[model samples]
Target chain A: MPGKSADKKPSFSDTFSVVGGNFDDAGRVSSRIKGILKKMCLPFEVIRKAAICTFEAEMNIVCYAQRGDITLSVDEDRIVIEVVDQGEGIPDIDLAMQAGYSTSTAKIREMGFGAGMGLMNIDRYADDFDITSEVGKGTKLVMIVNITEGS
Target chain B: MELGFIVKNLKLMVRSGSENLTVDVNGGYVGDLLSDVIANSKQGDIWITRQIHQNIVAVATLKDLAGIILVDNNEPARETLEKAIREMVPVMVSELPCFETAGRIYQLIAAREK
Candidate 1:
């Protein structure tokens, strides 16, 4: 079956608050994105994966950046989420992206997250993952998922 | 035991606006994460948590929960409450912390069902 192609794209700008280092505030952002995807009738599995990825990325912001925001752009064929934060930059992007690698504080681990699976999970779920970090400057993550591809 | 007894024991408020926090809950599960709660909680079980976000409703719906009880006297944001009301899933507010609320609900469920 051929998919419908559209020349026009719908864009949305939404901001969610990430509390400073609070486990309670985790996953709030992803939930919003998930709701948006659901309203658009996207596949449940894809939404689920995106939710998980967004959560880990947002948590990274809270744990390291102290506060952050996630901005999303949805097009006909892809969903692009940009997680930007002014938190301390990843000292080693390679180490951070490695599965089971985490710089979480003890407090975060106690809350049942931060087991070092955040970034790797993001990579596994996102079709495209890019991270730009400076040791002291900050970090920006761009994740693009093509939902119609592998299905 | 009927659901009325459990509601009487906890003195819970029906925040879901479904006309009852009064459903018979068969078991209890407590977790802040939606994924864990979705994976662990069984149907007819009461979910106890302090997360008062809108997504909690969707998780509860997916898991087919009897009701959701927000512990620690936490109030969900207005928007979340509005959605829950629309979903017709009963929500309760309790002063007890998550742990205590879980125990109380469990004891109530077990006692009534037994």
Candidate 2:
């Protein structure tokens, strides 16, 4: 009898480093990850959720941090994404998570990002989400999305 | 209704991405708040907004929107037009006010469903 592992797709991983304040390439990393997910033949909805979360994370880095790293790891049934950044972290996590609360400067707002929904959007799109930060230090987010049941 | 049909009926100016005029139109949602649009809009929906920034292209692309209609004569910044074309999302404009254009779009799609 074949083992359960044999029935699962092989695992894959990718990492991208995003520069903060780089508005031009804010969504570049997410776009690349989306392309990879498309090749994996994941369902449309799943890919879309992943893209939104990744894009939001990337934009957060661009808006507030000095730089960040995004990692995509897929193992059979689930896809996990982790983003870690270095910058001025949120002072009040609860307030920041509110739908419309924003600390974005006028410059970022003019470009259509930093609406204060980055964390919420990412949380909503991911099946499991976690965030931790230290003021003037950095922020990190981990988002896990199920791929097996998606269609 | 098809995107081309909507464009013709509304007499909107196709500012860019003319080649994407054929994208199938499913519905329309009007909003300028970026995060709200991202959370509330549906796939293949035609987004009506006053935001003419390039980041609009990223939002629309992630949502797989059919096209974008900017109201109140809000012309997109040059980079916005470039990104819209690169993403294959037609960006159109209307001299009409935001509410009026949204109303017309609602009627167009509602009539099609009937």
The digit string of per-residue lDDT tens for model 2 on A1-151 reads: 4776425664998899999998766678888888899899998888878888898898899899999999999876778899999999989988888888999999888766777788899889898898999999999999988886644
Q: How many backbone clashes does candidate 1 have?
A: 1
Question: Please, what are the lDDT tens digits per residue for candidate 1 over residues A1-151?
Answer: 3554334454655667676566544555666677887798887666656666676677677677867778877776777788888777888999887766777777665554566667777777788899999877688899877778445
Candidate 1: docking tier: incorrect
Compare the candidates by lDDT and give the number of the best one: 2
C-alpha lDDT values of all predictions: 0.71, 0.86
lDDT of 1 by residue, B26-68 (tens): 6778887554564456767778888776667766665557777
DockQ score for model 2: 0.53
* DockQ for all models: 0.10, 0.53
Clashes of each: 1, 0
Return model 2's CA RMSD, one decimal: 3.0
Clashing pairs in 2: none
Candidate 2: lDDT of A21?
A: 90
Model 2: residue A28 alpha-carbon error in angstroms: 1.7
